[model samples]
Target: MVGSLVNSSLVGCDFSSSPTSRKPIVLAHGARRGDVVALSSIEALPTLAAFGEWLRKPGPWVGGFDFPFGLPRELVEHLGWPLEWQACMAHYAGLSRDEIREIFRAFCDGRPAGGKFAHRAFDRRAGSSPSMKWVNPPVAWMLHAAVPLLLAAGVDLPGLRPGDPARVALEAYPGLLARELIGRRSYKSDDRARQTPDRLIARKDLLARLETGQTRLALRLKLTHPQRDALVDDASGDRIDAVLCLVQAAWAEREGPPGWGLPPDLDPLEGWIVSA
Candidate 1:
């Protein structure tokens, strides 16, 4: 927002609800000096509290975080929840996980077979799961857990909020970039047994494309040899997902606009995904 506010630092977060040492939240921090975007570090926040503190730290950063910032407007309205984003989130925060699941289940039960999940406008474009879905991906819970923290952190969410221009948070989906490089290819798995050679190869190819600037974003990723190995060796793909978001964060910095590549008619209550 100022001449001094050049793109200096960026971050990508692969978040988790109840992160432990085994499945910690991965944070990728990068800095852009000229054209090269260097991954300065990858840190793990083993608890939700730790991640919250990290986000609140002073920054002239544009972070692309891998979490849904809002629920579907359709779901919120149908459930008689608040239409305003802040009020809807406050209402959501008061409910337990079980309560959320039961309410969402009832909404789905009343819908037709193929239309069970109500989607935000950006969901289809970004190839993301419905924001109300509580299981499988549990992105519903991610929103339940993450948005409150974002609000508490008071970072600007572009079209969504005006908290801190110095600390900008954009909703990012790594699958969008990964899918762009390798369609429907599974590159990571939680189960050790499922981490196959082919998936590893896909990760390598994906990273290669990123470094070579194969994306429409026209930004090449710069990672050290150790950083490259760390990204590929982690079979969970959390590290790689964080890097994907880092690239998105860098792109957001370059866009330098009101919405930063989000849809012009983007719903304020249901925020759009960056680079969708």
Candidate 2:
């Protein structure tokens, strides 16, 4: 069921599969008031247990989390994983990280050079990394780490599974919106040495466009001066990415339920990214 957005807090999470004090999971808490999405606070969870604890808390909230929610259907079938969503997730969660990496590596090794990893349908649409990639962004590990927790927390994953209707969760990719605002110009880097002036300018330009409601979502970002500074000053882009996901959550909430602006043809086995 589509829960009442009027009373729901909109959340956007920039998740880290393996979180630490140095690089915690960042969550942006916000709500929509008419055309304006006001960011209220940003917080960090330093461990996966803390992240799970936060998920299990009471909710009349909708969240757009920056993590792959499902594996590619092709990959699952090739690996002979369960076809059923819940069952497949359970099988996946039972595997150790090393096992996962080995299995995925085998699959990739058999594929042609450029088309190494299998991709969910939405991956091409969203321009996201293949969910099976274990390095670089390590989104496969992200899915491995987060999905079970989401399932355990009993949050409603719109297309794939049903649980607490009030605690809705959607896959989000900030790059989708960021690219819309700034094209391909890089706006953030975890390396302090690479946090150049150009990236800082890019962040400001992106924020300016977002503040003016320049994207297709048409939702203005309402932030205090300090909030704006906090978002821009973080070279890692975790805070801004969380806010970007927050914007997507606001869009989904505004769209209301059933699909929540997700396509009617969304694959149940692979899941779709919100606002993709």
TM-score for each candidate, following the candidate numbering: 0.96, 0.98
Q: What is the C-alpha lDDT of each candidate?
A: 0.88, 0.93
Clashing residue pairs in candidate 1 are none
Model 2, TM vs. native: 0.98
Task: Report lDDT (Cα) of residue 26, candidate 1.
Answer: 94
The root-mean-square deviation over C-alpha atoms between each candidate and the true structure, in angstroms, is 1.6, 1.3
- Per-residue error for 114 in candidate 2, Å, reads 0.7
lDDT per residue as tens, model 2, 1-276: 364555999999999999999999999999998789999999999999999999999888999999998999999999889998889989989999999999999999999999999999989888999988999999989999999999989999999998898899999999999999999999999999999999999999999999999999999999999999988999899999999999999999988886788899988989999998
- Candidate 1 lDDT by residue in tens digits, 54-149: 879998888899989888999988989989888888999889999999999999999999999999987998899998998889998998889899
Q: What is the lDDT of residue 206 in candidate 1?
A: 97
**Model 2 lDDT, residue 207, Cα:** 93
